[model samples]
Target: MKKFLMLLLALLTVMVIAACTANEDAGEDPTDSEEPDTTEEGTNDDDEDATDDGTEEKVLRLNNGIEPSSLDPSIGFDAVSWDPLNNLMEGLTRLDQDSRAAEGVAESWDISDDGLTYTFHLREDVNWSNGDPVVAEDFVFAWKYMLDPETASPAAFLGYFIEGAEAFNSGEGSADDVNITAVDEKTLEVVLEAPTGFFLDLLTNPAFFPINHQVAQDNPNWHTEAESFVGNGPFKLESWEHDVEMVFTKNEHYWDADTVKLDKVHFAMVNDSNTQYQMFESGELDTASIPPELSDELIDGDNVFIGDYGGLEFYRFNITEEPFHNKNIRKAFAYAVNRADIAEYVVKNGVEPAYGFVSPGFTSPTGSDFRDENGDLVTFNPELAQQYLEDGMAEEGYNELPEIVLTYNTSDSNKAVAEALQSMFNEHLGVEVTLENQEWNVFAEAQQNLELQFSRSSFINDYSDPVNFLESFVTDSYMNRTGFSSAEYDELIEKGKSETDEEQRWEYLYEAERMLAEEMIAMPIRYYNTVVLEADGVSGILRHPVGYFDLKFADKN
Candidate 1:
C-alpha cells in the first residue's frame, strides 16, 4: 500500500505542473512583441544625451514678438510685453523667481500701529544703470508720477489702492499730496485708507519701480525720448526704435551685479509667429511660437511648455449704455451666442473656454473663489439663454434684435474669433452683428472709451487672487470703462474684503459673480496659454500672473 501511495503522489505533481504551464501559455502570446526605443526623439535628457557635441557660447538671443515702445514704466504698458520691462525696472517688492512676491528694490518693510501705515527699509548700496545711487526718493517719485493724472499711466490703477491715490488720479489732489513719503535717506513710509490685503503684490507692480525723478522732470516725454532713461534692475535700454527692435545692456551698478550673467539682452519686433518660428528654426531667432493656425501640428509632449495661466479673455458689453442696461437683453445675448461653438470654432488653437472670470489652478490667499451657486462654475446653457432673450425682446417690443457692433483687435487669432462670433450671434440668436476690426493700440483706446457697443478684452490677474480680476471692475476702477456698477455687487465686494469668516467671504464673492453672470454683465470667452519663444540658453525669465514677463534676474545658461 505505501508503494502504491508514493506512485499516486508523483503522478498528481506532474499533472499540476502541466496544468500551470498550459494556463501561462494561454495568458500571453509570445508572437506579439515590441522592440526597445532607438528613435532620436524618445531619448531622455541627461548629460550624455544632451547634444551632438554642441558647445555654443552662452550668449542667448530672445526673439519676443513685439518691442516695448515705451521704456517708461507708467505708460500704458501691457504686462504681456513687459516681462523684459520689469527685468530692467524692478519694484521695491517683486514677484519671486517662482511668481511669489519677494524683496526687490527694498530690503524690508514694517507696518505701523494702524494697519493703514507702512515703513519700508531699502538696500543701501544699490546703484542705477548710470551709476547713480538708488535712493528711497526714487520710488517715491515713481509712485507720485504714476498718480499724477497728466502721466496718463495705465499702471496708475495699482497706485489707486493707496490712500489718496484715487483723488490724486482723478485730479482732486496733487501728486505731491499722495500718501507716500521718504522718511530719511533709506526709509520710506506709506499711508493707506484700508488694509489692502494684496499690498505686497501691489508693490510688485511697475508703477512702484524707482526711476531717476530728475530726468523724468527734466524731460516730460522721456518715455519716448532717448534722454530720459535710467535703470534700477538688471538691464538698461541701450537703444530702441518704435515697432522695430530694442537693445539692452546689463546694469554695471545693480545690487546683484555679480549674479547677472548676461551682458546684453535684445528683442526684435517679429509679430508674425510663422516668420518668427522659421527664424528660430534657422538659428537666427532663439525662440518662436506656433501661430494659432499651426499650433496643433506643433503642440505635443516634446518641446511643450505646459502650465496654468492667470489671464481671462472675456467678452465685455458696455453696461452703462442702453442695450446692456437691460439685464434681460444681456441674458438674451449670452443665450443667443454659443460658447461651445466659440470654444471649438471661434477660439481654435487650444485656448480653454472660460466658464467664469477666475480659471482653475489660480488661487486667492486672502480671499475665496468667485464661483456661483454650483460653486464658482457655470457652462453654456443655450435653452436658458433663449428664454431670457425671448423675454427681453418681448419687453422691448421687438420681434428681431437690431444690428450690433463688435469691435476686436486686429490680431491674426482675434479676427477669426470675431468673425465666427458674428455668424454665431446672427444664426443662433437671430441677432444681426457687425464686426469692426482695428489696430491693437487703437482698439485698446476705443474699448476703454466705451465707444464700441461690444468688445473683446482680456485681463490677466496681477496676483493669483479673486480680487485682482473682479475688483478691477468695481464702479470706481479705471478699467471699468463699461460703467457696469451695481450697488449690490459693490457691497458684496466690499464685504468680502473684511469678512473675518473665510467661508462667508467666499459665499459673498460667489454671490456677486452669480449676480454678475446671471445679469449678463459680460460673457467670458476663454483662458489663454501665454506662449513665448526664448533662446535655448536663456533661463530665469520670471513669469507672472499678470502677463508681465520680467527678466531682470534672468541669466543666460
Candidate 2:
C-alpha cells in the first residue's frame, strides 16, 4: 500500500509539471501579467544523467539573489527568507498545486458562518525534525510571540486580522486578550475582529507558522545555525555557512516524506544575477534567474520560463524629509518618469506599466478587478512635471531644489533602472538626482528603517487580496516606512475590511487606491514578471503568483 501511494504521488507530480511545461510552451503563466516569455524556438536535449554506484543522485543546485535576512519565521519577511522558509516550515494552510489554500500542518479546518471564527484540525503524524510532535500549542506560542512587542516582527501587522492582535502588538492590551487559542493538542481556534474574506489565504504567510517554543527558549539564535535549526516541512537544514551557502536534505520525519522525491537541494548566495546565469551556463547551477538584458540572448532551448509574479516596483519618497515633504514635489517626481519607456526598454521582461500601487489582476469578490475600476490614475507629462516642480519650489519658498539622492540595491537590472530614472529626472524635471547602490541586505535594512531619502521599492503580494497591498500604508504598519499617513486613508481600509457587502467593500478599497494615487505618496513603476532559466531535467518546481518558487515536488531526471 505504501509503495502504491508513493507511485501515485510520483505520477501526480509528473502531471503537474507537465501542465506547467505546457503553459510555458504556450507562453502562458499565472503571474497575472499578460506578456509572454521570450523563448528559443527549438527543442533542447534532456540533461545527461550521471550514475554513481549504479544510481543517479537527485541533487539540485540553485542560486539565491541575496542572503536571507532571517530564518526565524517571525522575523523574516522578504523573498530571501521566504524562498527557504517555503521549504523549512509548514503553516496551517499552504499554496497548493493550483495556488489555492491547501492542507499543511492542519489537515482540515472549518469556518463559522459569521466568518469571524476558524478552527483547524492538525495532522497526528507531523513532527519537527527534532522528533518533537508538532501540536496546537506551538502555533499559539508563535502567534503570541509575533504579537509580543519584544519580538518586533516587522510582519506583526499581518496578525491584525485576529480580534485583539493589533491591540496586543501595539502594547495596548495583554497577550491573553489576543484571540488565538489552542483548544487541545490537535485543535486550534482563531477569532477575527470581523469577517475577512481572505483570512485563510493569509495563513499561507510565514508569520502564522508554528514555532517550537522550547527550542526558541533554549536557543535564541537557533535559526542562525544549522545545528539548531528545527523544521517540520519536507526538507530540513543540513548546513548553512552564513551569506555563502546553505544545503537542505529531505526530512524522513515529514508527514508526506514518501512523496518527497529529491534527496537534497543546494543553495549558493550568488547575489549577482549575471554571475548566477554564467554559473548556470557553465553547468555549475541547475537553476538561476536571468537579468533583463540577457533574457533574449540566454534562452538555449526549453528551460526558460516567464511568470507575472504579481509584484509592483515603485519609488518611495521620505515624506518627513525636506523637498519630498512638499506634495507637489512628490507629484512632480511621479509625472517626470515615463513608466511605458521603462517597461519596454529597461524591464524588457514581460512586465506591465503600473499606474497605481495595487497591481492589476487583484479581483474583488464580484470578480471585478480593482485596477480596472481605477484606470491610469497617474501619467507622464514632462510639461506638467516641470510646472509641478515650480509649484513645489514656490510652496517651499526655494529658488532651486537641493540635490536628491535615489538609492537602490546592487544588481544589473536595478542599476539600469536607477540610471534610467536619473536621466529622466535630469531631462524632464531638470532636477539632478544622484544614485547610490548598496548590497541587498544593507539596502533592505535601510529601506525598512526609512534611513534613505528616496529609494527603489517593490511589494509582492503576501496574499492575492487587495488588502495585502492596501494595509501596507496604514499608519501603524511597519511596512509603511514612508511616514505618509492619513486618517481618511485608514478609515477607508477599515471600512473595506469590515464591509460584508462584496461590492461595497471593493468600493472602499478603490477609494483608498485613488486617494493614494492623487496624493502621489509613492511613484509606481512597473508590475513584475518572474523570468528564469532552469535545466531541462528539473521538473515539478512551483512558482507562486506572489513571486516565490517551491521545491517540495521537484525532481531531477
On TM-score, the candidate that comes out on top is 2
TM-score of 2: 0.89
lDDT of 1 at 516: 68
Q: Give the range where candidate 1 is weakest over 10 consecutive residues by summed lDDT.
A: 31-40
Q: Which 10 residues in a row give candidate 2 its minimum summed lDDT?
A: 27-36
- What is candidate 1's lDDT per residue for 135-173, written digit by digit as tens? 778888888887788977766866765888878999888
Q: What is the C-alpha RMSD of each candidate to the true structure, in Å?
A: 16.5, 10.7
Residue 170 of candidate 1: its Cα lDDT?
Answer: 91
| Candidate 2 deviant stretches above 4 angstroms | 1-54, 299-301
Q: Which stretches of candidate 1 lie over 4 Å from their true place?
A: 1-59, 67-69, 320-322, 344-350, 364-378, 498-505, 533-535, 553-557
Candidate 2 clash pair list = 31-308
* lDDT (tens digit, per residue) of candidate 2 on 115-174: 999999999999999999999999999999988999998778889889999899999999
| Candidate 2, backbone clash total | 1
